[model samples]
Target: MNAERFEALAEAFGGDVARWPADEREAAAVLMAARADWARSVLGLAGEVDTALYAYAPPQASVGLADRIAAAGPRPGRGRWMGFLWPAGLGAGLAAACAAGIFVGAHLSAAAVSAEPLEPVTMAVSDQDFDFDLDGEV
Candidate 1:
């Protein structure tokens, strides 16, 4: 009903009144009629801008250029996961190799430790003080 309410309705519906609901259509029509002066000013400004835009002509485009570009198709490349696959595979291989090395080292260490023999120590006395002298008259 008021200018502010009309402006809000206009902003929501834009210039197309057909998009508004049947119940609100009558109210919008009444508001539009009441705000004729404001509507005329806005329409005049839009018309001037439209005329200015129409005055400038775009440059002529080459024939068949758009078709040629469309026909060229997309560039050749890998997918998003393709870039990560190689690095992931490489990391897994390195981890497996490290695990195998650790296993082998542990086994070798265990074998070396088990194969070593422990030596036994003994205590004995030497008999070097007793000497026989039976070479006098024989």
Candidate 2:
């Protein structure tokens, strides 16, 4: 199809070529015809190509395979409780661990502080070598 005609068709059909405006029904019909012709040509070639592809046969199972599969019983699907149980249990465990850690830390700190003795505050000074010279020296 020519570029101008394709552009006109594109505009008439809005952005989606599959949809057409009622006002441009005639133009939409022409575009549809062109598209149908193109699709028919492409589909014919696709059918031939598909026919040329080689067919594949699945491998056959061993004689005892059916018996073994039947013996295994139905496949186990996921349990509903596990979905809620695991997360809830994990969260509870973590909260307990955090609380235990905080309690231990505070207890140890209190014990250490209480065990230590308070030191006495003292001041030392040397006596003056000379006697008091408190006489008035006018």
Candidate 3:
């Protein structure tokens, strides 16, 4: 690798060439051996950077963070299990229900109409035919 790329890799992966990407490690080693003085300077800077980074202290999380998380409760699965009951699914379900209701209502209406007996198709039928003479007369 060129001096620039070797130096960049050393800076990125720290002073340890072994920790560098395996594909570039051999080339980086050859370049470093060729220019020992440059390699020493670059490695020294990388070591210093690593030391400073390792010494950093991160800020802790706010108080009651665990309690807040615990109180929130476990969330339900929002994966494929609930994919069927979507905006489109709701419409499909409603359409299916309406179709079923129409089928059942049609059957019920037909049954009701057929259940009651039809009146005889008589032209001269009169209420008096079934009435009794209140007086004792013919």
Better of 1 and 3 by lDDT: 3
> Which digits, one per residue and each the tens of the lDDT, describe model 3 over residues 75-99?
4673553455553576887788899
Model 1 stretches with alpha carbons more than 4 Å out: 1-30, 74-138
- Please report how far candidate 3 places residue 14 from its true position, in Å: 3.6
> Which residue window of length 10 is worst by lDDT in model 2?
11-20
Residue 90 CA error for candidate 2 (Å)?
32
Error of 1 at 93 (Å): 27
Ranking by lDDT: 3, 1, 2
Best by TM-score: 3
What's the TM-score of every candidate structure?
Answer: 0.31, 0.25, 0.41
In model 2, how large is the Cα lDDT of residue 95? 84
Q: Tell me which of candidates 1 and 3 scores higher on TM-score.
A: 3
Q: Higher TM-score: candidate 1 or 2?
A: 1
* Model 2, CA-based lDDT: 0.59
Question: Per-prediction RMSD in angstroms?
Answer: 24.7, 24.9, 16.4
lDDT of 1 by residue, 23-42 (tens): 77788677669777886564
The C-alpha local distance difference test score for the whole of candidate 3 amounts to 0.81
